[model samples]
Target: MPDSPYVAMGPRVAIRHTERNDRAEFTRLSRTSAALHHPWLTAPSTDEAFDIFMTKLERDDHEGFLVCLPETGAIAGFINVNSIVRGAFQGGTIGYGAFAPHAGHGYVSEGLGLVLAYAFGPLGLHRIEVNIQPGNEASLALVKRYGFRLEGFSPDYLYIEGAWRDHERYAITSDMFEAQG
Candidate 1:
């Protein structure tokens, strides 16, 4: 068997491409993060959710990484770059969430930094965007701290929990990434 090409964050914490062996932990993490949403989390089942998550993992249009804690071998969070648009626009959107236990410790921020590096450095993605609900103060604060510029407000941009939620669009380009240094 060839070695896994996934990224590592720490002895216990890693940002790795999803693997079949990770299904159970990823399912647990998904269900946990879903609970934190204001609207409540909804999914068919852990197995079904795993299938959906794996579908994203297998696609070239997106990249998904699971944040795992080696001590317990549990998934603590997840990050992904989705809806990649190439050609003159080599960019993608960022989506992520942290499990309840992993929240408030800057885990997501660290994960975001690594994911952004992968997007801009390894993936050659020129721009990355985040669409977050205006009411999600935690998420808003996170993107702001990362120097993402507020682009605009998008109404009914995503369906979360159940209802169509409005989102505030934020973006960071490779130039912005360089400027930050």
Candidate 2:
């Protein structure tokens, strides 16, 4: 709550790297938010799973951030930028979720706007992609709000829960992002 080092701050939320100290609160939120997250994502809810998630952040290609409310420094969601390529690619894929308690309150919209600025500005990325399941209207809307163009569709894209899920790809290049902004 006190002395939290934030990476970015917006009107509705703040962003920061997920630390080992976040295990308890993050896991609790993930567990309780399952009803909202089910069929979409299964966030790391156990100690072992949280350990694995932390390891992903150690790699050069991945980064994990927590979306926290400024009032009390409480986590309301999470966003992960994965498979970052720094050379000619200069691109990454993003995965994100809003905890049930914070869902529909527009925190993701505000927080993700800051994520985009951070990615395109500080991270020096040229393009960012978000893949969403066809049925997930909420995710689709979130990307569209940021002006991510519908790129394509991937059948059996990512394996989630038990089966491979189809995903609709959406992306925004730096030029497109700047033009829209």
Candidate 3:
């Protein structure tokens, strides 16, 4: 457990489900992050990536949103709640990235609170998980701020930046949020 600079910082933020009209801006930001963090993804043409992103946006069972700064109308970050499973589990995995310029501003932290509320409150999801690369200290800290518990480490969990990387799994349950509330 390393100390986190984002333990408590930044002005609060709000997020809204990404709309069809937001596709162009979302695509630009996501692509920029991918280029910086996972250059191998650069080969995909914008249209090709837009199609893939639209698929995520169109799913009813899943959610994708952009974190917006009220004053500037800037998109600080984006989050996705995907692979939702119901029945005995009733869980989903969360994925997110901050716009390059917004990194380290605690924007994602505030946006995370909103995501958790939506996940546990409106979405009726019982549990949400986040998988972070071992080296992504910022993301790990962001998830921790929302009370996600370290579950385990997985090898070859995901392929990004042209190579497979290990991931640290963290999970939070609706019960925990309810108790905290």
Task: Report the poorest 10 consecutive residues by lDDT, candidate 1.
Answer: 36-45
Clashing pairs in 2: none
| Model 2: CA > 4 A from native | 1-4
Better of 2 and 3 by TM-score: 2
Off by over 4 Å in 3: 1-11, 34-45
**TM-score-sorted candidate list, best first:** 2, 1, 3
Q: What's the CA error at residue 150 for candidate 3, in Å?
A: 1.1
Against the reference, the lDDT scores of all candidates come to 0.77, 0.90, 0.75
Model 2: lDDT of residue 47: 86
Weakest 10 consecutive residues of candidate 2 by summed lDDT: 1-10
**Cα deviation in Å at residue 83, candidate 1?**
0.5
Mind giving the per-residue lDDT tens digits that candidate 3 earns over 82-101? 88888888899988777767
- For candidate 3, the per-residue lDDT at 11 reads 60
Report the C-alpha lDDT of model 2 over 1-181, residue by residue, as the tens digit.
3676888898879999888889999899989998899899989999899989999977889888888898898788999899999999999999999997888998878888878888999899999999999999999989998899999999999999899999999999888888876
Candidate 3 TM-score, true structure as reference: 0.84
Best by lDDT: 2
